[model samples]
Target chain A: MIERFQYDNRIVKNFLFVTIMWGVVGMLVGLTAAIQLVVPSWNFADWGSFGRLRPLHTNAVIFAFVGNAIFAGAYYSLQRLLKARMYSDMLGKIHFWGWQLIIVSAVITLPLGMTTGKEYAELEWPIDIAITLIWVVFGINMMGTIIKRRERHLYVAIWFYIATWVTVAMLHIVNSIELPISMTKSYSWYAGVQDALVQWWYGHNAVAFFLTTPFLGLMYYFLPKAANRPVYSYKLSIIHFWSLIFLYIWAGPHHLLYSALPEWAQSLGTVFSIMLIAPSWGGMLNGLLTLRGAWDRVREDPVLKFFVVAVTCYGMATLEGPLLSLKSINAIAHFTDWIIAHVHIGGIGWNGFMIFGMVYWLVPRMYGTKLHSVKLANAHFWLGTLGIILYAVPLYFAGFFQSLMWKQFTPDGFLMYPNFLGHTAGDQDGLRTARYRR
Target chain B: MDTLLEIKTAYVLRVIGGSVYLTGAFLMVYNVRKTVISGKLIANEDAEAPPLEKMDQAKESGHWHRWIERRPIQMLVISLIVVGIGGVLEIVPTFLVKTNIPTISSVKPYTPLELHGRDIYVREGCYTCHSQMVRPFRSETERYGEYAKAGEFVYDHPFQWGSKRTGPDLLRVGGKYPDSWHYYHMYDPTSMSPGSLMPPYMHMFEDLLDTTTTKRKIEAMRTMGVPYAADFPAHANDHLSAQQDKIVASLKKDGIEAQKEMEIIAVIAYLQRVGTDIKAKEVVEAKPANP
Candidate 1:
């Protein structure tokens, strides 16, 4: 009665390559955007301006790079965990090529100024449709594999993957509903406050479903395997999974606090966001404790080192997310680089590092050869860690500075930085002069 | 027996928590090692062992078990519960709390032309960069004049309330500028305010305003509970013409000449209407003293 099958590692390998390539590209764009903030004139020209390219950089990294990486890891890990081959390799390829096409389209369209102007969901209707189709292909492929899985009693990671797939589908479909005035332009089906609600609901959860959950799934699978241990607690995994999913959705309204969203909704967002800390840290604790009695191994292994740092960063980001969701704290942090720093902690440290570790582990097995160089990987690891610190620390200072200056009042009760332009550009010239001296 | 029981209980919890945590951690590390230690990844030789083979057989036998299959549905129901509860909590209050938004007597809905102009503004992604809602904070009051109340936006179909403050709030810009000033500003933002970051809307002047959708838009607004007169759409053109005449006369009074058809004329009308209702609450005209 035994059934055995071979997983298509090739599709996973393809996705892994895309993840690395896009990761580098996305980070470069992010670095460029960061520089543009300090030196506004760097890419101030019409086509290359920060406004046009910011979306490009974000989409490139989030969707093109990190997104593909998530798919690669998920598919490869899921099949092995379930003791099955993928349900459809053809569907997998279609999903892969379709996603890449969408990324290409975004790269071209956003710079051309053909945007609906929603953050994260910036692609116009056509590209949005393409994303939807490709997403469905991925869903079908994933669901098909699950249906044919040899394992009963789906693992905690599979639960997360299911939630991610369903929730992302719901968020994308709901938020992308627009009445097109042109091929490239459209109005949201829900306008005004309703639109704001829907957009943030999708936006915040996009981080949750698209960014957080799948990565958590990856962590669950790869972490135990790396440390050569069974999962620490099955019951806690169940609790963490359900609690995180439930609390995460309501936390979206926190992004709209003190804005036009109803006060009650904002309050709901705050309450749920505060509640999120329990489950979030539960998962983080789960991740870290998996390495119990392996501290020595961690010191010797760059993979374990990356993972340790990644989980710790996850803990930091989850804690900061709830704190930032608080109205009082958000007053200072909202729209500032503090939010940027917080996000990168997750992006670079948690998601980026974890993915890097995953790729390092996966590539060798697939290639049927020893790694080309452990030293190179260690170098990449150190450089990446340094890059994250260099990128985030300055932004933290900048965010704090911005908040203080914006709120600063003159002796006569006028704003100390009254002119918005002046406030944004304050001391730029001086900074530039100092840079030149250096 | 008690000491053994206590130690056993503690050990159990620690193992549970620790194993879960370790599993999470190990997976991430394994991923890295798998990539770094490039060599023939020896597949688990035990993966083909007899006990695992039996477990795999048992798994296949019950793989389609209904209870096992229902997990995704259960997860879906839970997801729905979370999102649904939040939605109801948010929607119920905005619906029930009529007293939360006290009405201003002078606050009226936008006329057809003004509504069209507002749509145009939204189309150009102005709200992405500019905010219209003023918070109750002291800084907001001093900068934008008069804090915004929920009632002010009651008639707004999709509230134009913005999230970011990259540009100043436009809540109180009504009647603050002459029509000619708006004309020049929209045509070329730098012409009016030096170093203004707002993009010019020069195309507004050349693009013929699409009034064809005006009736439909008004009808949609009316359906959303705005108290437009039943004949409002039928007389929409008449009202638009009258509004344009009033705007042109006001412009001339300020030594500004403008044709009624100019896009600036409509945008001026929209801007001039901002924060006018709040003026009735205070006897003091809240004008910039230096302007």
Candidate 2:
């Protein structure tokens, strides 16, 4: 006998609501940080200084905004893909509330300057323990559902999902191994070059697994569904998944190029990072070409427009990603605003757009009503596209200008622009004013 | 036709390699089962899908990978092995190979006062803007005196060689300015380096260094392979006071004292300690003429 069960979409709805709330909060923190960069006086007391708030902004965005979006999408899609409700409603609630509590803890701790000083892995020991526990709960819930899945074929999308969970767990555990000195402070297990290597291995891949893989899963599911078509090529996707996972892991050293890290490891990172373009494009092509017959609908449908831009941004970033990893390019671009511009290209364009598209496609269906304003959604799309362009373009110009001035040595090997170019072209106040109401 | 044959040969080799890896993994799993499964099986109250007995018949007709997919346990284990292999390969070698980090004979451990100041630097997140790693590039070397060597950071507990460079590198900033420059800069950064984007570190002047933790921090450093001289921790307070008094005298010459026992003193001590090891000989020769 076949038993039917309603998908526990209430959990999905709760996560989706939290997504909007956290997105607003995270973006506001980020906006404030950008403002502080331009107007140093805006830095409030010690707790509200730019240095403290910068980590808060990053944590809030990565673990809060993007984190909640992943949960909402995963909960909704996992149930439907397996043709079963989540394995346990109790576990689902635990995962949801537990994650929120962790984000709340971060908000309180990071602003107080209680950090391990590692980027992305900045949360102190107690919070790190909480993260590991919550991650296990999430893993058990996911694995439980997959085991009891009524479907026969595990889709390529699920491959990405599985990789996301496993890689993130490994990254988090390895990076969070710190010796605590106080309630809110700790030291990394590794020091000097070793710490840099390990942190970037965790740091670079945090972007790969946390930001990239899960969203690729979302793209696989939502892009095809919205376009009313099947995927472009299943064989290509299979190739894309395996090659990406294997290649991405070796590319972390690219972030440490021309630094104190050993030359061999740096070279390894560059080679693998460059090779990543092949699989990245394969995934991008799969999404874009899936809308083969449905391309006409893109003009009217705001959701499809978001997916198109998202896929295109994915293509641009993946292409630029490899180019940036080249030793020649890295020598100049490593610490400059160019890297910031490249990251925002991926962050605002790819991840932000995908989330917006998913939210728009999902919200009405969950609420059992059509969208109240398609015109407003269209407005958001243009405004967002324009906003990203305005934010990224000026920084690219400034990054190159600053880099050139820094590198412009006289024939006698004295710094050419040391006294003349007194002020750095590093003013990024342009970023503060015009972000998408993200 | 020749290229096609080569491709087929590569594919066959891959099949052989993959099978060997998987078989070894399966043997380990079986070995664990022999030890644990015979002891006890935990009662799992989990819902499970009905098995498809048609797998053998359908293997010739259906997607080959689906057989493993239907068994989530096998799939999860396989995924774990694949992802786990890379981390093991990269990290194990780094830890085992002592030659990866070449030591410098001249490099010495931080003093008690300097150690506390380094910790204060960490607390301030100063690493966010001012990087400590001076690369071998001509631009970097010209701007910041000398290139950094790996062994120079042997005693930096968690290594604050920050990735970005919003400000100038600080690895070689020692002895570059008078004591008064740092004091005025901490009070108001714009006063010293006009148009600099750095914020004033005013609170550091008010907050006294926590002398209680100095002994514990020194002991911790010794445990981390930092070679502190014997009796260093016992006289840590005395050493800190002597260092503070010297800094106060130096600042008096410049007509300012941020505070004799303040956190600012500790940070100044740490900053002055940087890049001084290579210059120790020159300093000793010129010490009589410096003041």
Candidate 3:
């Protein structure tokens, strides 16, 4: 017998709207931080200095902007994929409000310089506890839905979601084991080289699970829906999902190249990072190939345009990631702005464009109307594309130029451009130009 | 290329790029708002689907992947194990194996005042801009000092081998300048190095050091396996105060009147201690023979 139920578009709408709102606030902060680099005077107050603002900007964009977008897409797609409503409405509300509270606390604390000093994991001990509790609530809500799922076999998208939830929980708990000295301050339980290993293991996977995996899940669901075509291959997606997650965990040590990290671990990182391109491209190919006969629609459809570019950027950034992990190349690019350029390719290009496409596709459908203006969306696409180019290209040049200058030696064996400021000063035009286009 | 000219040109272009991106962001906000306003929200949409079947696993057979997909808990557990393997293999060795991190006999733990200074460094998020690890490269060794070693950082609670160098590496910044130089530099970076991008930390000179937690900090570090003496926490503040007084006296000798209570004194103490242990001639000579 067929059962009657209603899909929770209310929760989906709530999450999507919050995603867009936070995206603006996060990007504005990011723009401010970028500008602070060129005009040091803009870091006018202690609370707004580049050091403080940098963490705030990163956290806002990653956790607030991307984080909300993930929840929005997950809620919208998970119900349909499972053919069921969410397990509990109360749990959904708690997850939403609790997450926002965490973001708000971050906005307050980071600028005030209350941090544990770990990159991306900077929230202090109290906030860390809050995060752990909220994450468990999210887990219970998700698992409860799965147990009562109306669908017999879990779709490939749900597979990605399951992996994401499990892996992120493990990574968080292991990395956040700190010895607290006060309400606001704590030292990492692991120290020195041990600490570096754990932090990057967490850091790199945060990018993988938090940024890459959930978005891939969304891509699997939304891309097919928007294009009105089935995914290119279900088998390829299965291979892609398993290999990608397994390979990603070992690649964290690439970030610690040439540092005091053990040599064998670095080799493991290099090997696994290179192996990752296979699965990464497998997913990329699947996304792009889904649009094969739909190429004509891509030109006129702004949603398709955003998706195509998002997939292409994923391909480029994934390839660049592995290449950079190579020892010789990493030797040049590791500490340079090259790494920054590479990240933005993924950040603005892959993640940002994907979120934009998903939002445009979902908003009109949920509201029961055609888009108010497809023209405006197309314009946003062009402007966003140009902004990414202007942002990344010059930084790539600057990174290479700066690395060369740093390594340059005079005929007399003395260092050329020995003053560190000279390299940054040299890149000023590139950086300044990129800032405006952003 | 003239480096100075390029710097100025890049600065101008960055502002323009920022403007373009800002415009896109506004356009997005405008578009989404209009879409929301013109259309009514559908909070719930009607749907019908057959209830999931209760399958007989012993009788029904299919692909291997499908079995796990039907069991969410099992899938979650298997995923946990798959992802767990790498972190365990990489991290367990570094922790359990003694030789993964060698200990430098000459290296010593930070003093009470320097430890507080390090805490202040962390509190300010200085690691965002300055790196504490100097890699083994000719350019870095020439620019900063010696290459960093794992053992040198044994007492570091969380390693400050920062990823970026917006200013420069500070691993070997200790003992390179007088207490007065750090004093002025913290107050205003441009006073020491012209065209510097580092912001002036004027607030450090005014904020009082919170010495109340010095004992607790010492005790905590001991628990983390730092070799601080068992009775050290009781006298930690006295040691901190005595170090602060010496730093104040040195600042006075350089014609700068600094109070012992200021947070800058601790910062100065920490800065003066970085990389100084292994810098001694005997330590440098003793290095290769031990390991």
Candidate 4:
């Protein structure tokens, strides 16, 4: 006998609300960091300096905003795909509250200057332990739902979800190994060249698995649903998933190019990173193709507009990723505002747009009402798209302008931008102006 | 003649392997298309457990991928292995090979004061803005001094080779600026470098250097195999005091008060020490045995 159960929209609804709340907070912090960069006086508190708050901005945007977005979409879709409610509501609630508590701890501790100093992995020992525990709760809850599924075959989205959980759990555990000196402080297990290698491996993969893969899973589900079309190709998605996971791991070393990382590892990183363009673009094509017969709807619909820009930005960023990995390009671009443009393309354009679209799509349905304002939604889509273009394009130009100036030797081998005007303040003024326009 | 024949056979085998792989993939696509076309998807298909005896007798679950998908724990464990393989393969070999980190004999370990200062630097997230590793690029070397050697950072506990540089690289900043300059700059970055975006660390001035963990930190670094003096942990306070006295005198000369073992004094000692030890190689290389 088969007994039907209601899909647990309540848990999904909770995660969705918190995702929007935290996203605003995270963006506010990021805005402050940008402002602090332009107006140094904006560094108000002892802990409010760009150096300190930068990590907070990253952690908030990544773990809080994007992280909760993943949980919301995954939870909502996982039930529908598997044809079962989450295994245990109690476990789901535990996972929810535990994650928020950890975020709260990061807010208190990070500004107080208790950091591990590893980018993206900045949360200290205690918070790291809490993240591990909550992640396990999430994993168990997810697996339980999967195993007892009424569906015979798991969808491509579920596969991406599985890869996401397994890979993120592995990355988190390995990178967070540390020797503690105090309750709140610890040192990374690896040091110097080795540490840089490990941190980037974890760091780059954090961007891959956390920000990219889960959102791709969200796209796989939500795009097809919204467009009222079947996926463009299933076989292409399989190849995209497997190849991306395998190749993305080797590409981590590319971030350390021209640095102290050994030549062999660096070369391996470059080759694989170049190879990555194939699968990354294949996935992008797969996503955009899903909207094929619905092009007219894309123009009228705010949801599809967000997605159209998201997939296009994903394409732009992935192509640039390989270009940046090339040793020559990395040399010119690594420390410049060019890199800032490249990342924000993905950060704001891809992840930010996707989550915004997903949230807008979810809210009305969960509340069982029509959208309050289609005009407002369209306005948002245009403004966001324009802002990203305006913000990113100048920075790209400024990045090249800055690097060329910095490295330019006069015929006599004297520095060209010796006065520090064009390189620092002038280009940064371009960046700040772009930030304000946003 | 035999080598040429072997090479030809190898080439033939490669072609055969490629063809076989393509044939298998094509067959899989054909089979999948047929199955999907034959029936619509059953979104909530009712599944029942087969008899245990039959399941035991069936060594294989008829459909291999289906079997794995059904058992979520088994799938998760397999996924773990897949992910773990890359990290293990890359990292383990690097650790086993000591030559990966070149040795610099002149690079002495950090003093207690310098260690605390380094800790303070880590705490303040200075590495976020300023990278300590100077790359071999012409622009970087011309700007930051000597290109960083792997050996120079072997003693670095958590590696300060930061990925980004919003500010200038500080790997070789030691001795470039006077003690007073560091004092005023940390107190207020704008006061020193006009139009600089760095924040004021005046709070570090107000806070006392927390020496309570100095011994524990020295012990931790020693455990990491940094060569500290014998009885370093027990005598950490004495060593820090001696170092502090010198810094205090220097700051007094420059009129900054060096204020009762504040965090800035310790950070100053550390900044002064960055990339300075390798300069001793000239003297170490000149030494006679037992000197």
Chain A vs native chain A, TM-score per candidate: 0.94, 0.95, 0.96, 0.95
lDDT of 2 by residue, A192-279 (tens): 7777778888888898898899999999999999999999998898789878887888888888777767777888889989999999
How is the predicted docking of candidate 3 categorized under the CAPRI scheme? medium
The full ranking of all candidates by lDDT, starting with the best, is 3, 4, 2, 1
Residue-wise lDDT of candidate 2 within B1-291, one digit each (tens)?
Answer: 222233223323333332332232233223333333333322121234443234454444555666665666676667667667766666666666877778767778888889888877777677777788777898888777788876677777677887667677899888776677777777787675555567888888888888987887777666666788767888888988999999988988867744688888888888889877867756676889987
- Pairs that collide, model 4: A192-B159
**Backbone clash tally (model 2):** 0
Candidate 1, A357: how far from true, in Å?
A: 2.2
Q: List per-model TM-scores for chain B.
A: 0.70, 0.73, 0.91, 0.75
> What CAPRI class is candidate 2?
incorrect
If scored against the real structure, what TM-score would every candidate get?
Answer: 0.78, 0.88, 0.95, 0.88
True contacts kept of 3: 0.61
Off by over 4 Å in 2: A419-438, B1-60, B229-231, B281-291
Candidate 3 per-residue lDDT, tens place, B15-93, comes to 5555676677678779988998999988888889999888663325766777877888998998989899999999999
Q: What does the lDDT read for residue A268 in candidate 2?
A: 83
Q: Any runs in candidate 1 off by more than 4 Å, and if so which?
A: A28-32, A39-49, A112-114, A126-130, A422-438, B1-73, B91-129, B154-160, B174-291
Which number leads on TM-score? 3
Model 2 chain A weakest 10-residue run by lDDT: A428-437
Q: For model 2, what is the error of residue A318's alpha carbon versus the real structure, in angstroms, after optimal superposition?
A: 1.3
- lDDT (tens digit, per residue) of candidate 3 on A212-270: 99999999999999999999998898899999999999999999988888999989999
